[model samples]
Every structure is written in C-alpha cells, then in structure tokens.
Target chain A: MSLPHAILTALLEKPSSGLELTRRFDRSIGYFWSATHQQIYRELGKLEQAGHIRALPAPTPARGQKKEYEVLPAGRAELTEWVARSEDPKPLRSALLLRMRAAAVVGAPGMREELRRHLDLHRRQLEEYRAIEVRDFPPARRESEPDRLRHLVLRGGIDLERFWVEWLTQALGELER
Target chain B: MSLPHAILTALLEKPSSGLELTRRFDRSIGYFWSATHQQIYRELGKLEQAGHIRALPAPTPARGQKKEYEVLPAGRAELTEWVARSEDPKPLRSALLLRMRAAAVVGAPGMREELRRHLDLHRRQLEEYRAIEVRDFPPARRESEPDRLRHLVLRGGIDLERFWVEWLTQALGELER
Candidate 1:
C-alpha cells in the first residue's frame, strides 16, 4: 500500500526513469520505506496504467528500454490526500528481538556473537548517517521548509540507529552477565 | 518463519491450548511480533503436522474443541539451532516517515495534526511499557537468566516507543516553525 505512494512521492520530487528511481531508492527513500527494484518497476507500471503517472516523451520508447515517468495531477492529489489520512502506527516486529526471547527458552550460547555483529552493523550505519548530516545539514545555514523536513527525516534515521547501537550493547552486556 | 519459532517459544515456556496461546500472544508476545488468531491457529496445525508439537490428551478431542500443545524434543532441537543462527537486521520501513517525506513534496497542510496524533499514541505506549516494567521487573528482585533475557526484550520495546515519542515531538516542532 505504501509502496505505491512511496513511488509517487519519489516521482513528484523529480521525473526519473525506472533505473533512476531504483538507484534513488537504494540511496535515499529506501532508508525509511524500502522497496526492491522489481517492486518499484512493478508499481511504476501500475501507476502508469492507473493514470497517476505517464512516461515522458523519448526518442524511442521501445521494449526493455528505460522510460522516464512524471506524476500526473491525479497522483499529486492522491499523495496529498494520503499525507492527511489517518493511519495507525504498525506494531513492532523485530525478528532479532523475537530471537532473543526464544534464546531465553533454548539457552543459546551463540547469541553473544550475533548481538556483537548487530552492534557493529548499527555502529557503521550511525556513522554513515552522521557523515551525511555533517555534509548536508551543517549549522548556520538557513533551510527551506522542504529542507527542514528532509533533515528531520535524516535525524530520525540517525536516532534510530543510535537506539539500536545502545540497546544491542546493553543486550550483549546482559548476555555476558 | 519467525511465527513458528515464536509459537515454539511460547509452548516451551508452558504447554497451552491454542486458545490460551492466542490470548498470551495478544497480551505479551504480540507487543513485539504480532499475529492474528487465525494465523496462530494455522501455524499450530502446521506445527502439529510437522511433528514439532503434539496435542495433549483431552477428554473430548473433538474438531473445533480446544487442543493443548507442547513442544516435542525435535521442536526444542530446532528452536535451539535457530537461536544460534545469524540473521541480519531487517531495514526499517516506516509509513509515517514516508508520509512526512511525501508531505515535504506536496506541502501537506493537515500533517500537523497527524504528527500530534502519533505523538499521543507513542506517549501512551511508552507509559504502558513503563507500567509493565514497574510491575514485572522490580529493582530488588534477583532475576534468573531467562528473566534477564525477557527483560531485555521488554526494554527494547520501551526504548523503541520512546524513540517514536521523541522523534514525533521533534517533527511536530519542525512543522510548527
């Protein structure tokens, strides 16, 4: 459900071919709402068929060739409505947390290493996010409304990674004790 | 995949009827990894067929009647192996964050209220988790290994809720400005 809207959002930001969309997803939008390249391509077709988007005029629109897409009025209206729509926060579903609980019953001796591994991963992610912040959002620069909102989203990612790094460290300590 | 293992963990903690398992999931396990009663029941049947679990002796044992289940040795072995397995953490996929990013493009006028609503929800959830912490993990109590691991899981839930609360409040502030 959100994937279509995610695609619509990315398209509204800028017209892009499917390949460009996939690449952007891997870099930016996917940080929060991930979609595989296949899913993105599939959704692009559905959006086009639904008249929410259209392929830009190209020299040759042949099969298997890249086709650029831009959001139509319908797509923009739908996305705007979705922004105001009420949706409940989905329940947390972490397989790692579930595994930790399962280990409680089974007494997993190997989970210590697993927790360590997760710690390393979160640390790396947090570092990458911090780097982006320093590069893109240095202080003393006036930001537009969109820039402010986008920076806030990046902050969310940084904070979430920090949470995991701290929690996993605590979990590993619990295991050691 | 994790649902079956979650069922096995619950059964190993205490043999229970399908009805009872569903209730427990709603109360505790569902907080982290939620499943509908229908899915729980379906998995119960599959686990039984797979010989990972078995029904306990009951007087009636009729169809549609309650059937108690306990994990078998094979199930325990499987769960133990699963606990030792390494799995990467799944990427975050949050609709609210996506909505925020979308709103940045479309200029959602109504998103201010939406952020407020989420802030309230996260606040309530955080309070609920804190209440559970007070009731279950008293400071003076000496916890066993299993209890420690279980407490860690609960802490994960609490910290996550807190993260949302903080982030949503910040988002609202940004919108206000």
Candidate 2:
C-alpha cells in the first residue's frame, strides 16, 4: 500500500522513469521510507497497468532508452483521497528491542552484555546523524525554504538518535549495577 | 538476520514457547521490532536447527504440549557480537517524507495539502504520546527507574512528532504564499 502511494506521490512531483524514482528513493525517500530497486520497478509496472500512472517514451540520448512516467488524473485523485484519510499509528519495528525484552527472561548477565552493545550502537548512530546534519545542511546554506525543511527533518533525526543514546546509557547503567 | 537474532535474544532472556514469545513481542519488542506469529514460529524452528537455540521437552501436562526454547551458548555469543559491532544504519524509511519530497517536484498546491495533512497527523501523534505518558507514568509513578526509561522513550516520541508538526506548519505556510 505504501509502495504504490510512494510511487504516485513521487510522480505527483514530476514525471520520472522507474530508474529515476529509484534514485530519488535512495537520496531522499530512503531517509524515511525505504524501498528496494526491485520493489520500485515492480510497483511501477503495477501502477501503470492500473492506469494510476502513464509511461512516456523517451528518445535515446546516446545508447540507452529511458522511459519517463507521470501521475495520471486518476493517480492524483487517489493520492488526494489517501492524504485526506486518517492513518493508523504504525508501531516502531526494531529488532534490538525484541532482543532486550527477551533478555529479561534469559538471565541478567547475557542481557547486560546485550544492553551494553546497544548503547554503543546508539552512540554511533547519534554521531552519524550529527554528521549527516552538517553535511546536508551546513548552516550557511540553510537560507531557502526547502533547505529549512530539510534541516528540520535532519534535526528530528538527530534528536531522536540522541534520545536513543541517552536511554541506552541510562539503561546500561542500571543493568551494570 | 534480525528475525533469528530477535528470537535468540528473547530466548536468552528466558526460555519460552512460541506463544509466550509472541505476547512479549507485542508488549515490549512491539515498540521496536514487529513480526507475525507465523514468522516467529518458523524462526524458532530454524534457530533450533541451526544450533543457535535449543527446544526443551514440554512439561508433561498429560494433554496439550508446548516446547520451551532457550538460546544456546552459540546464540549468546552471536547476540553479544551483534551488540558489540556497529550496526550499519538502516536506511531512513519514511513514507511521509517521500510524499513531501515528491510534493516539492509536483508544484505547490498539491504539496501544500500534503504538508497540511502530515502536520495534522504529527500533531495527533504528539497528543497520543502525551496521553500514553500520562497514563503509563503518572507523576507519582515517575520515580521508578523502569518507569523513567519508558517515559523518556515516550517523551522522545512526543518531541519528535512535535518537531515534525511545527516544521510542516512553517513549511506549509511558506508554500501557500
């Protein structure tokens, strides 16, 4: 469901080929909603068949022919309806947490070790998020509206990571004792 | 990788049957990792065969039987290894952001509606988080360590959602102009 929505949403911005959608997914959508290249390709075919999108023939620039796609009116209407509807709250899906919950039952020693390891992982994530923020939105270049929006999203990522690290730290401390 | 690890980690906490593991996954691990009951059952069998976990004979109830599983030493070593190592950051996977990025390309009108919709969603999430915090950790219960940790995670969720709504609000304001 999300995959089709993502593709239509992408086309709504502008028409692009399956390949272009894959690239955009990597650079931007991957930040939040990840789809494999295979998944994107598969969905494009499905959407096109459903008439939610139309593929336009592209002239070969040099050696390769690329097909571009645009959201059809039906696609736009579907997307609009989706946007207007309420969404269910999807739960967080982290493997690490599953392990932690099980650890409580396993015994303290092993659980303690696992918690320590998670703490280190969270720390690394916090560092990486910070780096992405600096790389993606250097303060000097954050003057435009889009840049500002990007910065805000980046900040949310950084803050969430920081919180995880802090929680892991505190949890580790408790387990150590 | 995550599936087996999740099962093994849970077993390490305490040996449990597939039924118990599913319940635990719903209550706690559900916050991070989610899996269907079918997946859990399949993985448990795989883990036992792979020598990562062991299934003990079911206690004689003289009627129905359910086998309990414990993580083997090999499993413990694996979990520890995973904890100690740096996890490759999972790609940012967000559907909402993909929509926003696509909106940017499509032109302002549609994008504005998308942003407004997202903002409303985030605002509602923030409220939900607050309600969970209050319900889970009333002021009197806040002094416990576990409660505090739970509260912290909830607070983080609340803050992140709030940040998103605020940013979307501002972004929408500009896009409307």
Candidate 3:
C-alpha cells in the first residue's frame, strides 16, 4: 500500500530506475525504510502498469540498460491522497526479541551471551551514526535549524543503539548474578 | 525460527496457560516482538505435539479451562543452540520516513504538518519513556555499573524522541523559509 507512495517519493526526488531506486534506498532513505531488490523491481512494474510512473527511454554508457522513471501526474495525485488519508500505524516485526524470549527456556547463560553480542552491535551502530553526523553536517551548521533536524534523527538512531547496549549490559549482569 | 524459542523462554520465566502467554507477550516481549493470541495458541499446539512442551491436565478455573505448558528437555537444548547462532540484521521499515520522502512531492506546506504531527507523537513517547525510567529504576541504582546499561537503553529512547522533536522544528522552519 505505502510501497507505491515510497516509490513515487523516490522518483519525485529524482528520476530513477528500479536498480537506481534500490541503490538510493540503501544510501538515503535506507536509513529509515528498506526494500529488497526483488521488492523494488516488483513494485516498479506495478507502478508502471498502474500509470503512476513511466520509464523514460535512455541508454547507459557502459552498464546494462537501466530504465528511468518519472512520476506521472496521476502518481503525484495518488501520493498526495495517501499522505492525507493513511492513518494506520505500520506494524513492526522483530525476530531478535523472539529469540531472546525463547532463550529463557534454554537457560540464562546463553541468553546473556546473545545479549552481549547485541550490545556490541548497537555500540558499533552508535559510532557509525556519530560519524554520519560529523560528515553530513558542517560545524557551524550543526547548530543551525535545518542541520539540527537532520542531526536530531541521527541522534535518535544513536540513542536507540546506546539504549540497547545499556539494556543488554544490565540484563546480562542480572542473569549472571 | 525464533517463535519456538520465545515460547520456551516465556515458559522458563513461569509456567503459563496459552491465554496467559498471550497477555505476557503484550506486556514484556511485545515491546520488541509481537504475536497474536491465535499465533500463541497455534504455536503451543505445535510445541506440545513435537514434545518440546508438555501440556498439563486442564485445571478447573473460574471462567474457562486453562491448559498450562512446561518446557521439555529437548526444547531447552534447541533453544540453547539457537542462542549461539548470530542473527541477521532486520531491515528498517519506518512509515514516517517514507511519508517524509513523499512530502518532497506535495511541496512544503503539507509536509510541514505531517512532520509536526510526527514530532508530537515522538514527544509523547519520550514522556512515556521518562516515566518508565523514574518508575522502574532508583536514581542511585541507575548510576551503578549493571544498571547503567539499562539506563543507557532508556536514554537512547529519550534521546531519539528528543531528536525527532528538534528535527521537526528545524525542518518546518526550513520549509517555511
């Protein structure tokens, strides 16, 4: 449902092919939403069939042929309608916690090790986020309005990672004791 | 894959009826993973049939017949093996960011409103997290080494929410200008 909107949004930012969209998704919006190459290609076909976007005829210099897409007026209208009307909270599905809950049956020791691993992963993520902040925003602009918002989202990611690390440490300690 | 483990873990915490497991999931593990009552019941049946969990005779209850579940030795072994394995990184799937990217098409005005609404929701989440911190951990304990991990996780949630609010304000300003 929202996939069309996501596709349209990506196209709106700039005309792109299914391959390009997948790449862009990884680099930019990938920070928030992700789609597999298969999913992206499938959605692109649907959007084109629906007349939301059209593939522009173009040739690549050295790479395989890439189809460029631009949102049609209809696509723009549909995206607007979706933005205005869609209110359902997107459900989140996580397998990690499921594994943790299941681990409780096996015993506490294994669960502690799993959590320690999770903590390490999160700590690394926080470091990556901090690096993005430093590289993406200039020093003076870091405090500026627009940069602040960008920084804030990155901060959110960092904070969540930090929290996970903290929770793992505490929970692991309790389990050990 | 993790479903079997989660059920075992819940049972380890305490023996529970299928209905009780559903409720416990809503309160604790639901924060990270979610499952419906139907899924819980179905999983329990599978586990019982597979010899991973044993269902005790139904007890006469005030409202209905309750079937309690206890983990079998095999289940414990399976869960331990699972814990030792590494989990793949789950893909991000945030509707908010998808909407924000789409906002690039609707021009600035409508997008600003959406961003503002998101910011408000995050603010409420921040407040909820802060309440959890105060209610769940004592100040002194929060500062301790073990507790510090849990504290960091909570701080992450807080910081993330705060970052969203700040980003909303600045992004809105940028759109206005």
Best by DockQ: 1
lDDT of 1 by residue, A99-151 (tens): 99999899969999999999999999999999999998877433788888888
Interface RMSD of 2: 5.1
Ranking according to TM-score, highest score first: 1, 3, 2
Q: Where's the lowest-lDDT run of ten residues in candidate 3 chain B?
A: B144-153
CA lDDT, every prediction? Answer: 0.91, 0.67, 0.70
TM (chain A) per model: 0.96, 0.72, 0.78
Question: Fnat per model, in the order given?
Answer: 0.88, 0.32, 0.43
- Tens digits of per-residue lDDT for model 1 on B33-65? 988889999999999999999999899979988
Q: Each model's TM-score, in the order given? A: 0.97, 0.65, 0.73
Better of 2 and 3 by lDDT: 3
- Model 3 spans with C-alpha error above 4 angstroms: A58-65, A86-136, A139-177, B59-65, B111-177
Tens digits of lDDT, candidate 2, A1-177: 678887887777668887888998776555577788899988998999999998775565433467788889998877766644445446556544444444433433455565566667767767876888778778786777656655655655665566667766766765565
B64 Cα displacement, candidate 1 (Å): 2.2
Per-residue lDDT over B27-64 for candidate 2, one digit per residue giving the tens place of the 0 to 100 score: 54544677778999999888878888887865574434
For B26-124, candidate 3 gives per-residue lDDT tens digits of: 765554556889999989989989998998766564446778889888877777777667776565676765665565457433566666677677777
Q: What DockQ do you compute for every candidate structure?
A: 0.88, 0.26, 0.32
Ranked by DockQ, the better of candidates 1 and 3 is: 1
Q: Which regions of candidate 2 are displaced past 4 Å?
A: A59-64, A95-177, B59-64, B99-177
Which pairs of residues collide in candidate 3?
A102-B5, A102-B6, A149-B167, A156-B160, A159-B156, A163-B152, A163-B153, A166-B149, A166-B150, A167-B149
Summarize candidate 3's per-residue lDDT along A102-132 as a digit string, tens digits. 4433433455666777778777877887888
